[model samples]
Target: MPSRQKKVIFCIAGLLSFGCALSVAVAIGTQFWVKGTILCKTGAQLVNATGPELDKFVGEISYGLFHGQRVKQCGLGGRPFQFSFFPDLLEAIPASIHVSVILFSAVVIIFSLVAAAFFMYNAFGNPYETLHGPLGLYLWNFISCSCGCLVMILFASEVKLHRLSEKIANYKEGNFVYKTHSEEFDRSFWIILFCFTVHFLNILLIRVSGIQFPFQESKETDTSTGAADLMY
Candidate 1:
């Protein structure tokens, strides 16, 4: 490929990285805000004061219901506990909304990398299953390419489910029901990793694909060596 074409390809990869990272940052940041403490406290207070029966209904629609996944995880892991997954899934709606945003970002990342791989494959003219050479490069691009989203599915499933686990009830304090801080951050890190992985792979394809992987041609073709032979 011509130098100008390569430059354009690199620029596009840069744009993809920036867009995906910015999106992941915004989605994760905005999530907890809508499910803020005041909302939880208000629901809990209503449940405690007037009627426990009302609490069930309020919890069903609110973030409190999301904790069922956490309880279920523990139960599945041989921890003896009982909780309804239905309400947990219900409370998880806020997180479900947030995860949809993450999925959107993942989709973008996958497309960006696929474009990069296509560029590299054509530019270098390397065979798809390049034998005995530079397997890492192929693996690198594959992770961010079309296949990356399927890899992301595992993380998405675990984290999205964990979102439901964030809900748990604690003893009431004065006018408010107690708050137990959630674990949304843990899952968020993985989402960020996926975004970064996309950027990393795309950048690697842009920078490295032009050069033969696991092989260097510089020394054999040195210009100085040819000039010295003429002088001798």
Candidate 2:
């Protein structure tokens, strides 16, 4: 590609990286990561609620990394409660896995910013051939993508394998046992997935900007050098 075309491609990738950074940041602070309903098992059993009658004993739950809100129901009515993860519910939940998810999310945001900066530098400035150059762009983007994937995987495990919703629903309940009726990842979780996709796309954009993959570039240079030596 021509120099002008390469600059444009780099600029586009930079914008995308910046966008991913902002999107993930917003998602992390939101309480829409997981949304579900919890059924009051004790109340339902006591009343032997069947069919639509079960709805009276079911309530909504939604949460994110930091804090969340849930509506509790036990055949009486819905009672709203708010919660936090840091010091409050840490014992009731998988603190290690939850913290790991948050850590990877922060990593994704930081590396995304780094990738965006590098993309802009590659587009408009003369960067060093080492960490500040095209290879660095690939490294940063790949890190961001990998971290995004980790965020999703770790969170999914925390929710599913660890039974996060049930734990939260029955956190302080003494007489009632709550069971998860339904659970699904919400928009905030999907935003991380979108960020992962954007970083992957940025990798392809780097290639489209006429930069060869690192190993391929080195192999081709070696082949050319060998051919020149043979001719000499």
Candidate 3:
């Protein structure tokens, strides 16, 4: 690749890495990972509510990894109640899985920033042998991609397979009891997915910048050596 093309590719990859980092950070901090409505099962049963009266027993819930809000619509006009995960709800499996998700997200952000820095360094600054070369780009981008994928997969499993929203809603406290009616991943979840996809795309961008796939390069080297030996 020409010097100008290399610069453009590296710059684009760097910008994408930064975007992934920002998206992961925002997704971690926001309470929009999962959004759904829950029914106040106990409340409905207590009042023997039926038909339209049951509508009053529904509540809105939205939460991320750390904190969230629950709006009680059980005839209370959507009074919001805030909740936290750490120390407060850590005992729950969903909370534990979410904590892991957050950890992986942090990993993704850290490695992505590192990759972006390396990209810029290779593009403009003087690069050394291993740390600032095509190998380094591959390494950093691979790590970021793996971590981002982990974040998405873990969160998705918690929500879809483990029924995270339902678990959180079903948690009871003294006289309070809740039941999940329906749940789905919200904007933050999709943002995380997008970030994962971006990191994977960055890997492709690195390859397009004239860096051979690491394994393929090694295979070619061995094949050349064998051919040379046969000629000798």
Winner by TM-score: 2
TM-score of 3: 0.89
Local distance difference test scores for all models: 0.43, 0.94, 0.84
* Model 1 ranges off by over 4 Å: 32-197, 200-204, 207-209, 213-232
Which 10 consecutive positions of candidate 1 have the poorest summed lDDT?
Answer: 69-78
* Displacement of the residue 163 alpha carbon in candidate 2, Å: 0.8
Ranking by TM-score: 2, 3, 1
- Which parts of model 2 have CA positions greater than 4 angstroms off? 228-232
Candidate 3 local lDDT, residue 68: 89
Clashing pairs in 2: none
Over 4 Å off, model 3? 47-51, 94-96, 128-131, 228-232
Tens digits of per-residue lDDT for model 1, 109-174 = 555444445554544554454431244344445455433354345434544554333333332124
**Candidate 3: worst-modelled 10 consecutive residues by lDDT:** 167-176
